[model samples]
Each structure stands twice: as structure tokens, then as C-alpha cells.
Target: MKTLWVLVIAWASVAPAASMPVCSGGHRVNCVVDGDTFWWRGKKYRIADIDAPETDASCEAERRLAAEATSKLKDLLANDFAVEPTGRFDRYGRRLVIVKIDNKSVGETLIAAGLARRWQGRKEHWCPAP
Candidate 1:
């Protein structure tokens, strides 16, 4: 009984992040370039804030999981909305954009959904007038 109870508590603690639904980031785009890259309007974009798992891994499970996450993000954004650059250029040279679906900022939406992290470290001015 004691061992079973401990196992249950451990599973409960890790479940939320694992079960978290894959949702769209507020900056909607066309597709993923890699685990960390994406495309929007003939331009390439890297996620401005979060460092997701790298595609390279010794374990196949780790690699597949990262690929799946990127695929899920792209799948959710397909044909769903229009987006504009946020006026910020990330270190990778992709223009940051405020994605809009039905006139909603995709960035805000993604953050709210816990799909993407708020990039408070990035300066707002980096997003150019668009």
C-alpha cells in the first residue's frame, strides 16, 4: 500500500506537463524548419523565447518526441490565420511577428495556452514597424 501510494503521487506530479495539450503559439506561421525553426510569409522564424529540445539525441525516443512537438505546433497553425512581424529580430535573424487569428495576437494566445513562453527577455523594440 505504501509503495503504491508513492508511485501514484509521482505520476500525478509529472502528468500535467506531459498531458498538456499541444496548442498554437500566438505567432502563427506556415511550417517548421527544424525543432527550433519555423516559417511565416516567405520568411524564416525561430521561436523567440523558449529553447525546446534539440532534434539531436542519442535516444530515439528523445529525437522523436522533439520532432513530434514541432510537427504539432505547425499542424495547429495551418490555414488558420494571418500574421505580421512583431518588429523584433531574434538572434537567428528571423523577424518576430505578432500572429493573428481572427484578429487575435497569436503570441499572447500561445503564452496563455502554455504552448509558448513569454519572452520578457526580448526587447519590444526589436520588432520593427510592420
Candidate 2:
């Protein structure tokens, strides 16, 4: 009985850490890595619910938009912004978060500007095939 109780306690402790970080409040961003990623207090975070063009894109159009997205994210994070975790993490270990600037989500802003798209469980092409 005692062994079973110990195992249950151990599982409870490990479960939350294995899931994802939950942001009850917010944290100051240290730097913006891209339109969908940033650094806060030395930890890397990925914006939740949205995906942006990759910085190392091959297609010309994708590359161009990726640069624009990165620049826009940099500008947003340069001010007094905060990141709210989405209680999830990507496979790459980036914390899924929502960046808020003036109470507006940066991801939503990027999507509105056509620089990003809402993440739908898979990556979508940023440019058409040649």
C-alpha cells in the first residue's frame, strides 16, 4: 500500500512538468527570434495558435515575408510586451505562448497583416509551389 502511494505521488509531481508551462500572468520578453518565437528571461518561447514563415525559407516569396515577419516581431517586442503561456509546448521544447502588446496579441496582428496564419496542427505552405 505504501509503495503504491509513493508511486502516485511521484506521478503527480512529474505530470505537470511533463505537460507545459502555464502562464497565469506575464513575463517581459528579452528578445524576438522570429514572428512566432521569442526569448524571455533567457527561455525560448513559441507563439501559440499561430505559425509564421520560417526565417530560413527557400522560396523567394516565403523568404521575403519571413524577413518582414521577423522585423515586425522585433519591433513589437522592443516595447513593453508580455508573454502569456498557452499551457502547451511544441515538440521542439519551445514554450507555446501568446505575446501581448497593449493588450493585443502579436500573433493575431501578424495574421491580420498576412505575415502569419493560425496554426492548425500542421504547417502550411507560405508560398505556392513553382
For each of the candidates, give the backbone clash count: 11, 0
Per-residue lDDT over 8-122 for candidate 1, one digit per residue giving the tens place of the 0 to 100 score: 5543211111221233566543446543456654467655544444456556654665666566555545535554445678776886555445656545555554444556674
Candidate 2 lDDT by residue in tens digits, 92-111: 99988877777688789999
Prediction 1 TM-score vs. true: 0.48
Error of 1 at 62 (Å): 8.4
lDDT (0 to 1) per candidate: 0.50, 0.73
For this target, which candidate reaches the highest lDDT against the unseen true structure?
Answer: 2
Query: Over the full model, what C-alpha lDDT does candidate 2 score relative to the true structure?
Result: 0.73
Name the TM-score of candidate 2. Answer: 0.74
